[model samples]
Target: MTVADTPQAAAFRRQVLIPLKLRLFLMQKLPMAWLAGLRLRQLTPEQAVVTIRFKFLTQNPFRSIYFACLAMAAEFASGIQAMMHVQAGGPVSMLVVKLEGDFTKKAVGLIAFTCPDGPLIAQAVAESCATGEGRTVVCTSTGVDEAGDVVAIFRLTWSFRAKC
Candidate 1:
């Protein structure tokens, strides 16, 4: 069976990762996410979503959300998926080797970023475990504004290596 199908991993995600307070605790430790008021809106084996509110701290001089804050939220959306896979499968070291962001428009109000490639990531981690080698996956995070307009698209290349 695949690691993602394991019961223990599934339990951990539902009982631990799904709770807002737990997610908040994690975000609090991350200074940028905390400053941006990032929230974990949803997390599953198939997708992860994060939101950052447009506030004074996150706003730029142009009266829009800072690009960095948007990038932070987008990274979280993709990173959280990798975290889930690592948590479920086994010990693995993961990092964002590269990041590419496209700001299509001004980010205002509440901005939500979604990554819908969790399953693919899980498979890659499983392969890495089996081969005892590192794997890289390019995950896409799409950011949308409160009005449902596309604000930005972030592509993050995450590398995962199994622990020795």
Candidate 2:
């Protein structure tokens, strides 16, 4: 059986993964995220929503949010879902193997990055555990402006492997 296919692991995920305090502490450690004013607005087993304020720190000379800052928010949205899965299943190693971004519209004001691919990530992890081989999944995170317009879309490829 996979490490995450256990009752204890599920309990740990419930008690540790979805806590606001832990998320706040995590943000503190990520200085760039903190400086860019990234916030974890919501997180669940199925989705994660992250936001970045288009303030001076996050803005580029073009009067829009910096590309890197947008990338950071998008990554957080995608990564948080994978984090939840890995935390619940067992000690697994996960990394972003690839990233593709489309700057659809100028990112202005507060941007919300939303990713809804938790089930897909969980399946990839289970596959890796069953096969004892690495599995990769592509997750898409979309950034929306405060006016609900599409700002950017990022496709991230994540590789997962169970620890030996």
Question: Using lDDT as the measure, which candidate wins?
Answer: 1
lDDT of 1 by residue, 61-163 (tens): 9999989889899999988788778887778899999999999999988899999988878988888888889999999999998899999999999999989
Where model 2 places Cα greater than 4 Å from the true spot, the runs are 1-24
Superposed by TM-score, candidate 1 places the C-alpha of residue 38 at a distance from the truth, in angstroms, of 0.7
CA lDDT scores, all candidates in order: 0.84, 0.82
Candidate 1, residue 102: the lDDT equals: 96
Clashes of each: 0, 1
lDDT of 2 by residue, 36-140 (tens): 877777766677799988899988999999999999999989887787777666678999999999998998888999998878888898788777799999999
The clash tally of candidate 2 reads 1
lDDT for residue 129 in candidate 1, whole number 0-100: 86
- Candidate 2 yields a Cα-based lDDT of 0.82
Q: Flag regions of model 1 displaced more than 4 Å.
A: 1-4, 15-20
